[model samples]
Target: MPGLQTQSIHAGRSIDPSTGAVVPPLHTSTTFERDPDGEFSRRYAYIRAATPNRDSLEACITALEGGDETISFGSGMAASFGVFQALAPKDHVLLHRDVYYGVRELMEGFFAKWGLNHTLVDMRDIDEVRRASRPETKLFWVETPTNPLIEVVDIRAVAEAARAACALLVCENTFATPVLQRPFELGADIVVHSLTKYLGGHSDAMGGSVTLKNKPELVAQIRDFQHTGGAILSPFDCWLILRGVETLVPRVRLHCENARLIAEFLSTHKGVSKVRYPGLVNDPGHAVAKTQMKDFGGMLSFEIRGGRAEAFAFTAALKTIARATSLGGTHSLIEHRASIEGKTTRAPESLLRLSVGLEDANDLIHDLDQALGSII
Candidate 1:
């Protein structure tokens, strides 16, 4: 097999047969012509069902994740919705207590209304996972190095529980992209990603994917949902994500490097009450993360000394790192996750989530030092 870097550049890419272009041509046509015998010989009937660009993007993700098949969607939430839609009404899903706020909204706000059931549990506790299982449980949704809190879950342990319950295990790999962690290798049945993050690397595109590990029946079901539901990723966005995949390896390496330095810096600061990063030897998730992940990943969060007011002040004082919502881009971003998550937020009132970017490590530390100084 080709190395990750090599695969990133060459996988799903080919020279244009007719134009002789080195890069794959972006196919924008919504509909394809049929054969004279009323056959769609080219195999693509319409954009929603399939498209050249989307197929190429899906191929790249499938290869990178080492999955049997991958299904692309317009956004991360759409991909998640596709998975839930695959389950029958009244089926139960076990969600990480600190999973992305949007996912909670999807289950509690929308899916609940449709008779779908869900329960939130601390995935770090294998016993908690086993205790939460019900006869109707159909899925176990996990997010390692969880959103905002940066809490890591042991995938292998959780997969065991899922197996005993006869439930499908779905791992959200958005934070720890394929570069740092391979969930399928760790026993995940399905892997999902928000291409809007690390895979896009540049934040210019919005997309998501669900990759199945040898589950042919599930693949067909989700593919049918993707086609009939019409929430497929756009061709242009697919091309953009493919372009990002070419440099994912190097970009993620730098993200990990810079994040480690920043986490260490924050740990010793008096104004920071806690630093949540698996790279830290003292972190609660350190041992488990080190066993499963190649590196600790780029996202981290810390609690300010005071309350929400202090957290807001610190972020406002930063000159270089922007106060932003999303992560995995060229620019570093910081957000008070509590405020963003609203009333039901589990994030500490003093917590700030930082999305380390491809920037000078010293400069980022200095920027943080000055901001903490201002707040202190």
Candidate 2:
């Protein structure tokens, strides 16, 4: 009610009714209590219909994005699928070439089976985006500061094009959390997230969400699908993610601070070829990022001197950072983009994506230096 920052901890939740606990309790019941007299019914009657924890989490995200409604799913991919289904079978989807790999896999597999046509375009170039559009282009999917490579796209420009074409613009707002950016404010129709990441800052839970900007009917449609499809997030995971959202602002501040240091270190290192981070003054997307995002996010990517072998070694040798995938957590992670991409030319062979954590800036820098020492 006060602001996004305050609501992150208190928006959809109040004191516990039964136990008077500060934090909300996880409701594990398959069904909720109904009015015995049948005079009135509670807000939700079943887990699929609704849950207090799920509603609370949704309210927090909706308030953060200034959205009208929010929906939860088993994972980020489920949320994406809901959007995919919301579109007609023949509708076209245009996405940034460098978005989440899972999305590419879905586009090539599941969505293709449904007769949906899509394209991967360099959205930073408005002309390229304009040229990629057909009269059938019904959805423009964007992942700014994109996965692995960290390519920044123009949200407002793409939104404008979608508006003119009477299409919907959906943005994966995982990297730039609501603390850093709000895509709906820039004209996004739907804002999606992998709550398993930043929103659940600890690496303990897996979930996803979608907040709607203006489509109440679409919200009902997705709710019906989610109810029938039953890819709903569990009570425990939703509660964990809700608790995780509480520290989002402070955690993001540290993540950006640590990442800025790592980006600076990597930029000047002899072993690194190119550093990709919006925080860098000379980064290709710095100006646009500065205009859109409140601050440069914690994720950055850089190319090592050699190819795959050297990149793997660099990641494996990191003492402080973990070698894994999926970003925006409390522990720093270093991943070889080539291995995860399954041999896609989209990611450079020598590239390493860094997910900076809330560690001491100096310790992270030293760990990176020592790791690079093995290959430089």
Candidate 3:
């Protein structure tokens, strides 16, 4: 097998046979020509069903995640929806207590009306996971280094509990991209990602994917939902994601490095009440993260010493890091997660989630230090 960096650059890419172009040509045509015998010999019938660019993106993601097959979607939530749609109505799901807010809304607000049920549990505690498993539990959704809180879950341990319950373990790998953590290797049945964030490193594209370990039946169901639901990722976005995959390895390495430095600095800062990062030896999730991950990821969060007022004041004072909603780009972004999550928010009022970017580590720390000084 090629090294990860090599795979990132070469996997799912080939010299264009027709144009001999080094870069894959963008196939924008919505429909393909049929053979003289009235057969769609090219294997693509419609844009929604299949496309050259989308196929290429899925292929690359499958290789990166070491999964048997991958299905692409218009957005990360759509990919997650596709998984739930595979289950029958009245089926139960176990969700991490601190999963991305959108996922929680999708289940509790939207899917609940369709007879789909869910239980929110702290996935870091295996006992909680085991206790929450119902007889009808069909899926266990886990997001490690969980959104906002940066709480890590032991994927292997959760996988065991899911297995005992005969449920599929679906891991959200958006935070720890395959460059750092391969969930399939850690016993995940399915791995999903929001390409809008890290995989589309520029934040220029929006897409998502579901990669299955070896479940052909589930793959067929997801593909059916993708085609019938009409929420497939566009060819242009697929091409952009493919372009991002080429640089994933190096970009993620730098993200990890910068986050480590920033987390270390925040831990000792007087203005920070607590720092949530698995890279810290004292972090509750540090040991588990070290066992399963290549390195702690770029995302971290910290509670300000005072309150929400201080957190907002600190964010307003940052000159370099942008006060933004999304993450995983060339520029650093910080958000008061509680505000974004609204009334049901589990994030602390004083907490700020930071998405470390590909920037000078010292400069980012310096920016943070000055901001703290201003707020304190």
Give RMSD (Å) of candidate 3 vs. truth. Answer: 0.8
The Cα local distance difference test for each model comes to: 0.93, 0.89, 0.94
TM-score of each: 0.98, 0.97, 0.99
The TM-score measured for candidate 3 stands at 0.99
Q: Across residues 126-239, which tens digit of lDDT does each residue of candidate 2 receive?
A: 888888899999999999989978989889999998888788899999999999988988889999999999999998999988889779889988887788888799889989
Off by over 4 Å in 1: none
- In model 2, which regions exceed 4 Å deviation? 37-40
At residue 41, candidate 1 shows an lDDT of 83
State the TM-score for model 1. Answer: 0.98
> Can you tell me which runs of candidate 3 are displaced by over 4 Å?
none
Across residues 128-222, which tens digit of lDDT does each residue of candidate 1 receive?
99999999999999998899889999999999999999999999999999988999999999999999999998979999999999799999899
Greater-lDDT candidate between 2 and 3? 3
